[model samples]
Target: MEHRDVGILHPGAMGARVAAQAVTTGAAVWWLPQGRSAASRERARAYGLRSAAGIRELAATCEVVLSVCPPAAALDVAGQVAAAGFRGVYVDANAVSPERMAEITGVFEGGAVTVVDGGITGPPPREPGRTRLYLSGDDTAVARVWALFDGTALTPVALAGPVGRASALKLSFAAYNKISYAVAAHACALADGHGVLDDLLELAQLMLPGTPLAELEHLAAAGPRAWRWGPEMSEIAQACRGVGAPSGFAEAAAATFGRWEAHKDDPAVTGQRLIADLVQGSSSST
Candidate 1:
């Protein structure tokens, strides 16, 4: 279970940071370059990650593989690793529901790979105490994975349960955190459409003096990332129903996020522009 070489599948923003942290810990980090973008290649280079020709090479070479892709790709990534005959530790650190986590776990069933569920809370860790990676699985495997992250910016905490627990915790946390942002954006959009946005802002400031209008920033930031969040919201809705809770809010949040598909990742879009566009879209749709 001692992994000296770690492979990070598809080093996006969060994956790159995780690789950088592993590099700082002197672990040889590897990434697959096949089908990856130039931006991803540059990121791997900047993080000092070694490249493998493909998934098979990566799975064969590394002792541990960190699957940090989007939630939708989690199962496929696991399948790739499993098919590569990877017999080492596999960590899935995506934002997915417990049910999806269980499904991903099932992918590695009958394989030598030990599946560890990971839920990363907070943003990419740039400093100590900024984020935590919650791991749940077999005791020995979880400990091994936790040791890999020891002393890194991304603090790893071993959860006292099986694989799905970590993902359940992650989905539960994100359900509220992200859905609240969607609600705030929709509220602002409604206010803007009704010509009471300024009035609402003033009222909020007067009623809640210490709170800043972060919803505006959230909406602007969400424009590019809404595509991802839409699925995440749906997963959250599933998580809600799995726990016997009402899922109407999360379903609505998913629909609201879906409306932002047109502006997905548009750097030119501003918060005001996002709000106006969302309001206009709502108006036109009706």
Candidate 2:
């Protein structure tokens, strides 16, 4: 069930990551930018991706199309797929809600292209790691879609039923994971302020890996680097609101991340550096 070609719309971090995976899995990968972001352009250059002149070109050329654009761009890309008369499975793996997934599904209704509602969990496969990609469109091409990720970090799960379940699961998972990161960030910062970050770390370790202290350390230590997570936390906060859930921690930490973003581009700084400051700064100056 190998795809002859795979096209990635939006060569952003996640998109590029997935594209790298697809190509590594032996799919002849092509890509088009969502827009012109310098980082994305650099990634495309690094990966040697064949650029599609436009959506129509990509839609006409590829057999497997994956929409990894931003959550806001999800519907637009789906519409483009429909308009271009795409002739393959379009996996909508944006971080959008269930309602949005259904809307995208409608965009491809009765079209030659089949739409699979997919939510990608975890970062792009940098190594041979596995991140479950929950799929729920009930499309017959799901098995083929699964094959696309067979040797990659993605394990595609075709969840039985409607198209929104995978998106729902994604939102739910993001909500919890974002909250967990928020809690860890807050706790570690507070403990650092109280001059007990080391003690707190020790206490966190006693939980025998169940606690996310290690992850917290990574996030905190990667301070400027963690700024990339800012928008994601904000999106997670939005997801909770859309479903009547409390997103306090995510919201608060997102604000904290906002402060970090302000200095993310500093010559001598990174999210990790700021996190280290928060974790080890002097009490009086902290």
Candidate 3:
């Protein structure tokens, strides 16, 4: 299989989206049966991306395979790709530390597979071609991924040296993002506890001197509808665990997402609710 004949391996919604985006670059897309998520599977179906019976089929079929599964499942998928003898690139875009990536690479180092480390920053592209994706791997073919993204709307950059640098970048970014979300939610929830969500909003607007309250508000509001975040957040938690960071913080974030899942039908998924629920932990969230 040639690079142009590369196939994409996506196991979840992000993979589906990335696979969908891959079409613009003219790569073949392949995946396991779409999961239970209607919104995600629908997107893949709409794009006419091909579906395989299992991981074995995708590995045997795609030359260059990109996987965006959660960190917990990332290594497992890599092992599967190795078992299926996937030649060419096997990029793991999971939210994991560089150390973990190295371990994952060891599983297939002897095979024909070239492991590419990928890290995705920011949200999925709402409009076509605006997503930022990064790839890092051996000196060879890293540029292939960069060029693939360059050909599309995504701004793909290839980082040189070491297989894990890209994944390290992802973990560092996730740490900051998780912290920001946790802090922002906690602060606003404190305000709400004292009957000051609005007052905090006003004071924040005035005090911060052009803060990102509006954008942050959008993220907070989308919390309830963000069911897909659960698997991703679980990966974030595992990354934190790998590095000895306190898992309590990510545990809070997970609970926040859980509340959103529980009350997706309710329109009142506000900042206070997220903060209070996350602060209270997942079990007592009801």
> What are the per-residue Cα lDDT tens digits for candidate 2 across 110-200?
8887778888887676766557788876567777778777767767778988777888888778767655655676676777777887787
Q: Compute the lDDT for candidate 1.
A: 0.83
Q: Write the per-residue lDDT of candidate 1 for residues 1-286, one digit (tens) a residue.
A: 3348899987888899988898887789999888888989999999899988888888888888999988888889888898999989999999889899889889988988899999998887799998999999999989878877899999999989898899889888888777776777777878888899888777867775433244455457767777778888888888889989999998997887787777765766566765665677641211
A best-first ranking of the candidates according to their TM-score comes to 1, 3, 2
Off by over 4 Å in 2: 1-3, 33-42, 45-48, 83-85, 207-217, 221-244, 263-286
Query: lDDT value for candidate 3?
Result: 0.67
Give me the candidate number with maximum TM-score: 1
Which stretches of model 1 miss by more than 4 angstroms?
1-3, 208-215, 282-286
User: Best lDDT goes to which candidate?
Assistant: 1
State, as a TM-score between 0 and 1, how close model 3 is to the true structure: 0.80
lDDT values of the candidates? 0.83, 0.71, 0.67
Tell me the tens digit of each residue's lDDT in model 3 across 1-61: 2336455555454566667667766777776664546765677788767878776777777
Q: What is the lDDT of residue 56 in candidate 1?
A: 84
Model 1 worst lDDT window (10 residues): 277-286
Better of 1 and 3 by TM-score: 1
Model 1: per-residue Cα lDDT at residue 15: 91
Clashing pairs in 2: 221-272, 222-271, 222-272, 223-271, 223-272, 224-270, 224-271, 224-272, 225-271
